[model samples]
Target: MTGSGHRALGLAAAALTVTGAVLVGTGVLPPATPPAPPQAVEASHPSRGRTPETGSRSAAPVLPRSEPRRLDVPRIGVHVPLSRLGLNADGTVQVPPVDRPEQAGWYARGYTPGERGAAVILGHVDGDGRRGVFHDLGRLRRGDTVSVTRADGSVATFVVQSVEQVPKSRFPSQRVYGPLDHAGLRLVTCGGGFDRQTGHYRDNVIVYARLA
Candidate 1:
């Protein structure tokens, strides 16, 4: 897609996914100097596609306010602790440390998981020449489960409804981040192909899930 077409969605998704850092930062491990492989890209791209229809009944009941502490995706073999992330000085969502690519982060400014709005989580695909958290995110399928442990020692489970890949230029911000009538989850990662010149990905992979 042309840069012009991606500008708006790019900015919106960037505001929430920290895509600018992926485009410019070197994917090197902290306290080390070795240059990371070119393919070690962050999982972030501006993207949006059709929103999945919400079912009347959810498998899990929505809980009250609680911060997420851990995330587990059995299908992807992901079991990682989560850090709370806020916005940067530039007003974009703050991302997990690049050196600690194995970790994932939750957007603290938005609704907590199991609430009535869409909860967002982000992770890197690869860095420091190794697989990063969410590297297998694209492998998740409908009906797969994502479990998030909250601060209250409660586990809120979400079932995948759909997975989509859309170009950054066509990112559907409203569909992705807009208010939801039910508790929802969105997992975002960089996909498609890497753009060597821009040091970014051409598309984003989003996994939509509802409380179950």
Candidate 2:
């Protein structure tokens, strides 16, 4: 999907949901506070500007787009099947069920794995007081590899370009979800310090990767 279209679709809801979860996890908010409605979490962070993907390093040529079936990040010991996620009635991106926090999900409406754009994979940091699939996502570093297996039996490999933790309020939406020249990957989860009063993590950890 075009960057603008993605923004219009469910980006707002996705951002909100991510931020809300982080806040709730840190206990920054009341435990009684209900999770954002199904349509409440896509793209809670708005990106008004765009950043060009630039670097001396170049990723492999783009591969055909395909539905991702599984993900493997050896460094973090993650090997989980992927579920398709679409937008909710309110236009927020769909999220993996909280009850199955160990699973990861892909934004099916957006770029597919190996396509010429940024493919987003989201997972919870924690749920039910246990670690979620992406609990260690922040520990990844540049040069780490993330592999995604597609239904076609092809594996797309991505090399981590950068890993950053930024305040949810200052999330770099354009940079993270914006269109890219190559097949890019974005792994996201909550990070930073937990706010005792609010019950939310103050920051988000994003891992930027490109096809390899």
Candidate 3:
């Protein structure tokens, strides 16, 4: 996707609607009052031409374009098939259906997983009185792994580099969807407190990872 496309998609995805209800298995509700999003800024560490998660100086290898079939986050027990998402009539990005909280959606207009650009995946935090596919997204730490199984029968493994929770008003559009030097992946979901007035979460949780 182009820079403009990235910005648009990021902003649209950031505005996801999340219902603040009891979490499945946890039996806990989100805070009524929204908490301030994290203010930490990520510093880039350049090592030759390699991706941030790797030590090699050589350019990272990229795969040919292929649709992603599934996503796996072993640490959080997330294993779900991916659905193709496109822009809506209003030009906003489409999201996974709230009724199916266990499914994830991939930005079909952007780079596919394993391609030399950021491939974005969006899931709900919670919905339909149950925890969503990415409900535990905030618990992921640096060095965690996320893998995408592609249509070509190859899996693209990515190593988590950073995670951020930012208000939808200040979503990092450029950083999350901008062109990259190597293959990258971004997992996004709603977080922060539930807003009864708006029926949406106040913040978004984004995970940045690079091909490994």
Overall lDDT per candidate, in order of appearance: 0.69, 0.70, 0.71
Question: How well is each residue in 1-212 modelled by candidate 2, as lDDT tens digits?
Answer: 65665664346434544543532232323223222212222223334354323465354478887899999999999999999876667566566776666888897877888888788898877666666788788677778899999988999999887776666777776677666788888887776666666666766667778888
By summed lDDT, the worst window of 10 consecutive residues in model 1 runs over 30-39
TM-score of 1: 0.78
User: In model 3, where is the ten-residue run with the lowest total lDDT?
Assistant: 18-27
> Which parts of model 2 are misplaced by more than 4 Å?
1-60
| Candidate 1 Cα outliers beyond 4 Å, as residue runs | 1-14, 17-50, 57-60
Question: How many collisions between residues are there in candidate 1?
Answer: 7
Q: Name the candidate that leads on lDDT.
A: 3
RMSD of each: 8.1, 7.0, 5.8
Q: Clashes in model 3: which pairs?
A: none
Candidate 1 lDDT over 90-175, as tens digits, reads 76667777677788988777778898777889887666666678777777878999999999999999999877666666555666
- The Cα error of candidate 1 at residue 9, in Å, is 14
Expressed as tens digits, the lDDT of each residue in 54-146 for candidate 3 is: 455277889988999999999899989999987777566777777777888898878899998888898877667677888888777788999
**TM-scores of all candidate predictions against the true structure:** 0.78, 0.78, 0.78
